[model samples]
Target: MRDPLTEKPRRKIPSRLIEVDAWIDSSLWRFGHGFSRFWESVTIFSRRFRARGLNKLAVEVACEGLTLGVAGLIVMLALAQPAMKLTANGLPQQTDYSVLFLDRHGNEIGRRGVMRADAIPIDEMPDHFIKAVLATEDRRFFEHWGIDFFGLARALSENARAGGVVQGGSTLTQQLAKNLFLSNERNIERKIKEAFIALWLESHYSKREILSMYLDRAYMGGGSFGAAAAAEFYFDKDIRDVSLAEGAMLAGLFKAPAKYAPHINLPAARARANEVLTNMVQGGFMTEGQVVAARRQPATAVDRSTTTSPDYFLDWAFGEVQKIAGDMPHRNFVARTSIDMGLQQLADESVEYHLRQFGKTYDVGEAAMVVLDDDGGVRAMVGGRDYGESQFNRATKALRQPGSSFKGYVYAAAMEAGFKPDDKISDAPITIGRWSPQNYGRSYAGTVTLQTAIAKSINTVPVRLSQKIGMDKVAALAKAMGVESNLRGDKTMALGTSEVTVLDQATGYACFAAGGMTSNRHGILQLFDTNGNLLWDSKRDMPPRRRVLSETASAEMNQMLSQIPIIGTARKAQLSMTRAAGKTGTTQGYRDGWFVGFTGNFTAAVWFGNDSFRPTNKVSGGGLPTMTWQRFMEAAHQGIELKPIPYIDNTMPERKAPKVAEEGDAPPPVRPASLTTAAQKVLAQIGMLMSSAPPLEKPEKLAAAAGDDNAVGRR
Candidate 1:
């Protein structure tokens, strides 16, 4: 048969004009076959379902769904908003960014990024380049109102002919739409929403705007995005300088950039580039000679910037940052961290060294360190001796019993309540109601001033003061200075039985170090947009801090902390430092050890323990933390001038008569009303025990108390 127009083969259906009619009929048949194949599967599945009685159930279910589905859809639509499309920002996306770190002096100390591109302008882009992209990626890009039904049908037909699903039907518009306004879930509902957004964008903007957006946002090879980044990544040149071959290669990657990256396999990428060039020539965007030149001069370079990952620092710092700013979006965050790379280096080195030293001298090798400036800012922190073996940041995270370190708070509270530093207090087994706390040695300091008791980190003295002033006042005092974690309302907590993280302890102690003014610990400094517009700053309109103690009381507290470095438990921390102060804390049964202290300008708290609440190698705050503090301070303030502190004598009036203990190792009974009968019985039950505590001539039984029983819980 022949058509009248071509005049080639004319034979059969002459009278009926069957040649043109047959062409029309065949096109419709092909279309029908494509749809029928899809629909026939559904019909077959339905027949099998009917055989199993499932068809009746399905019809019933569909009827119910038909009744409620519209209402459910309305509810969901009501719930959905612009923000609902967002989920928690994932770990730093697979983009390589250049980092520039500087000291407080603005001297650059670190560099990571290269092969970069800032941004590209829409007018500067070649029109033919965009046309070629449309030809290859979405042929009807400019023709349709966003989504194209005909293009999708053609794609389905091609896939059917190929005997496998070899092509995707997602237009560039659909992809951009999804990237901007929909979640990336692979389902029909999301695709429908993407189409809606794309249609809206098409209606609101011009063709040039859509094309510019596509060129700017589409991901390219080697952790690059947009035409400009792709150009620099592939050829080490700007977008304006890209050759025809390079341009086509960049365009080819819109489907799967990683699979076609030149660095992954250059020969395959060059072949794809040649195919793109052929398409460009066919589309009349480029000449045949251009294709030949593009193939001849292939890309000579490929970006290798994605090879390294900041695995350790990124993993560690991300957890820390989330503590302060988890609610802030990850996209526009600027954490003005006090993290000094040099100080962090020193911290890592000191943790390794001191634990090794302690491992040799004693059996405890585990350690942690948390350093902060007296400005109420964290400076350097090491949560463990080895972050590689463990990620639990004990410095900022773990909440272990603070042991004698808690005595500092008790002593401070007593001082404010008129217990003078020079006033003498007996440190023996003293019973306050049902609780009795023994020293770490289970011995007593017979008669010593408050200064000597605290200097030696005495446990009994604090227990006495907590009873005299009442545990309510002590807990309130702790809370006032920023120890927001729970503190025991009962007398048992007075001996530091309650658990707290090293960070809160360091921060609470830092308040005293900073002359009694509280500054809430902060991490982020300010934030800016990608375009460098100011978004937020941490220093804006902050509240005035509450004063927790008088300067005179704070000075006395600092005096006790200073004894640690001068003549007490933390003497090893004295790196020729004059104005240093800190306290040592070892938990009951040696499960945790902490050393938290500060000088005039810095406060650092170090802790050591396991997250599973297992014991470490008998480590204490004085063991590794003291040495780490010394090492950090040495490097941190090198050649910086500082002054010495002068201590003053106590001038406050003394409180009422107190309880005193004898040289014995007996515990008090639970909830006793009278001291003699209950104390005697509890001692007899414990086997190796008792004498009535060498009785202080009773002046008065302690007053009744009011506070949380577990006032201090683990931080």
Candidate 2:
């Protein structure tokens, strides 16, 4: 208002604020001078002290010790974070149920889970059993708080002397901590957590309580947990009545259950038991005279070696039960599964026999098989060669390339798009962008019918057909059929580059076996409570089946697939009693080989490969997989009345004798008309090479040629 734009205005400072600012400046200056003087005095004193060599050494050592202590604290805190996240709400409640699984015939096949009632009190256990465990596992159980440093040192010394680990350093408390709150991983973090948990356990529970929990929590193999369960499982007797010899054997399993379980290997179990007896005598818990008798006789487990545990089936069915009754209040359940023990045994034997017979020759180490009834009931499953060595369910869990077997869905899509089995498609090499799929032999057949193309597994035909009908439609049809695995809509989809499980293959093939209806695949047929009250029934709870394919389309697909076991890549899969139809799939590099076939009554999918993903010795679906499928199917179709495949004739035709050619008369030469110029040139070069080379009479040379021939024709 007073010509502010041209005038300079000044604000007056308060006297109290100016005095406060001066005081703060004076205080800071005084503090800085005093600290400087203090630092100078300290520096002179430290230099004087360091002038003496002994004082300097002492200071250096002190600094190093403090640095290490700080670093150690940081590492400890980092490792403790995982354990600290666990709530201190006492030990977790025993939610494990005592599930008793039965086969389709109501036979008790096996048992799983744990029950609180199965726990045996410490005082009730046999005196010798308790002594044996204490002597072998932790001789200083009463001497140490939680971790036994002296025992660990002794074990380390012994292992150093032996140049191999012969004794475990973990105390019983540490083992209990691992079984309770930690995984079996052998990392530093897990070890730290285990030690911390062990200390916590010792602080909260008494010696007797800790020992009892240890005996009840450790896994004792054969799907049994705890000493009480092991005693009953191995000896068929209660823990209180276990004899000294049996107690020794049971104690031996605490170290390595799978390696020393008597049912698995009696010799190894006895050896481990003898070692336990020696430990008892050495620890002064028993006199040599008392243990000698037990060592001589050892222990004899019940004769369960002949009984094959349907562990894979039980594992799968258990998951199904959990899905169906996860919200139920009842903990204990009796699941009647759809597994037929006989068929299960057959499947197991067939897989094992083939692997043992040809596995080494073919360099295939593992195999999985799944069988289902026409109604989608899972009849049998073999996850691997041995359940003890590996628990990963390959039948239901392993995702492998299905190879050419996936062509069925593509063809089905084609059928739905108004293509016929007799529809002609060019099998010549065709490229969609940069991808040009070639047949297995690198040879193309000329214009061929859809049936002939699928039977022969001509790769170019399906790729062309998929491009025409659209891969999205093919993927939708495959999902509708029952392929639960995710399918990619890339051009390679028609070639089955996508991976699926053996169970998925079986389920999808079962849809075809069920006359194109949805395959409501299920494992658990019924669930019952302890009092026998029915809780869930699969027949009532399962969703109704829906139609996935029209009748004409389904029949055409069946007709095309039926040629496989007869004249296609799966000739070995033909059944003696009934007609079989399926597809053969061989992945790139022969890493996986599959034969998924369906009969009028059953559908089975077989896979052969190495668990490590190593390529086999050129094992193809037309070889071992189909052979195993044939073996199982022949045995599975023995007594039951055969059901005909939908829209297909099941009558067995008479076999005609082959006509013998006249002497010195050669058969006419045949050539595929769809061969590309490049393929023809390659064949011409091979012929020239063969004509100029010497006869391949040597076994190795012949084998090499034969191997090349096999690879060229693989499905």
Q: Would you list the clashing residue pairs of candidate 2?
A: none
All candidates: TM-score? 0.49, 0.71
Q: What number of backbone clashes does candidate 2 have, counting pairs of residues 3 or more apart or in separate chains? A: 0
lDDT of 1 by residue, 1-715 (tens): 7568665344454845877888889999999998999899999887775633786788888989987998888875654433234322421232233222222222222222222234467677655456557767887777888888888998899999999886778777777776555544455566666776676678777877777777876656554557776776677777876666677777777776766778766777777777777777776777888568767886555656434212233333444444444354423222234455555666666666656555555456456666666556555666665442333456655667887778778888887887777999887787666766778768886999988887788888877787789889888887887776787687778767787777778778878777777856653343322222334444562356767887778888877777666667776666443457778888776677777777665777777655556666666667655656666675665544443332423222232211212202322112112224255356535522322233222101100000112222111
**Cα RMSD (angstroms) for every candidate in the order listed:** 27.6, 17.0
Give the CA lDDT, 0 to 100, for residue 60 in model 1: 89
Best by lDDT: 2
What's the residue-level lDDT of 9 in candidate 2? Answer: 35
lDDT of 1 at 193: 68
> Which is the leading candidate under TM-score?
2
